[model samples]
Structure formats: structure tokens, C-alpha cells
Target: MLVKGQCTICGPELENGLPSTSRFRRLAQDNTLVDGPSLTGYYTSCPAMDREGTTVFWRDGQLLAVDADLASHELFAMDDGQNVMGRTLLLGDGRVVVSLDSEVLAFHSSLSPLAEGPWPCGDANLRGNPVMS
Candidate 1:
């Protein structure tokens, strides 16, 4: 079940619920959280990045993602990341080291995400009709 153009180096597959080896092992042996207190509503105030308000929402098992600052809603997953020239870098990458402006935080793979997914604007352009104007 391989797809074309999937990132080999980045290795993000959460958009599809698939994960690399370590992730698979964690799921198999680790505690599976269910029932009891659930995520009825959760909020976190990430480092602010000017201009306007910033907030994003996503569910544990849900696939769709929504960010408040965006003009229109996007289905891509992730939150509180920067938009580079054109590409987006998820804040939870093991490869990337996060810094807090004046203070530089520790650099370690311990911050790595359990799973990765397609890039921010990751979905392929598959919508619509063939009308040449």
C-alpha cells in the first residue's frame, strides 16, 4: 500500500494511520488509552506568533484539521507551526530543534512525534474537472 511522492526522508504517515517500526512496537506493547476521562475539550497556548490570534484543533482519531488563522479550513494535520517560503514544518519533528527566541531550548530527538503525516498542504491535487480555458 505504497503511494507515489510519499516522503522517504521525512517518513510522515499519520494521515494514513500507518507508522514506522518504533511506532508499531509502542502500539503493540504500550498502554492503549480508552474510556474514563476523555478529550471533551482541550486547549493549549503555544508560543505566540504575532499579527492575529492563533489556534488549531484536531481530534485523536479524526483525520480533518482546522486552524483559525487560515482563510479557509484545511484537512491537513498539525498545529502551531511556521509557514516557510512555501512549505510547512511541523513543530513536532525529531529532526528539527525548537527555540524560544532569546532562549534556545534543548536539542534532542526526545521531542520527536509518535507519528508523522503528509506535509501541511500534503494532499494531492485531485479535485475537479478538465476544462481548458
Candidate 2:
């Protein structure tokens, strides 16, 4: 989930009996801190997950893709000088769509195409229902 307030906290947790939680920090290509405990409201974009459990989100002008464990990850910098906000859409063909400050952009996501049924984009669906496909 996309966490706001003092910092941008994004991670995953096991939902079963023994629940475990982990928080990750956003780093630049040079491995420098981009957003974490030192920053406030740095996570400006929404998150989307594919059927295979790969997750995608944005932070500090960069797109982040991570596995379900929130371990292995990749980052893509947006050089268009715009920040992404609102919801992110995962297309049926493995494309991630988001709206920038002044335009719309689509990125080829590492995630697979969405499932056949209704898929969760971010926090909820268009009807504000918390159902997962």
C-alpha cells in the first residue's frame, strides 16, 4: 500500500496466521536515498499489481516494480519532469498507465497481463469496493 505523512512507506505483509511486515526505502540509481524516513510525502503515485503478484508504483519521478515479497525490484526514471498522481491502471497486455501533471504516460510493466476478472488497481475499484480478482 502507498503510505503518506512523514514518509513514503510501501511494503507487503503476509495475511495468514503468522503475519510479517516489511518496509522498503526508495533509492536512486546510485543507491542514494530518494525517499524514506528523511522525506515527507515523497510517494506521489498510486500502486498497481498484476495477476502474477508483481507490484508497480512511483516515487520521486521514478517508477518502481517489485515482487510480491517486496524484495527484488527495479526502478525507471521519468525524465519528462512530471510527477504521477491518482490511480495507476494495469492493462490486460502488461502495460501500466498513469496520468502525469500535464499528460498521460504508459510504461511497459514487468508484470503480466491482468487476470480475466476484475483486478485491483490500487486501494479500490471504481465503485470503491475492496475486492481482489
Instruction: Provide the clashing-pair count of each candidate structure.
Output: 1, 0
Of the candidates shown, which would achieve the greatest lDDT relative to the real structure? 2
What does candidate 2's lDDT look like per residue over 34-93, in tens digits?
A: 333221124445566566556565655766666544454645674555644656666777
lDDT of 2 at 3: 34
Task: Name the regions of candidate 2 deviating beyond 4 angstroms.
Answer: 2-41, 79-84, 115-124, 127-133
Runs in model 1 deviating more than 4 A are 1-96, 111-114, 118-133
The ten-residue window of minimal lDDT in model 1 covers: 20-29
TM-scores, all candidates, are 0.18, 0.55
What lDDT would candidate 1 get against the real structure? 0.22
What is the overall TM-score of model 2 with all chains considered together?
0.55
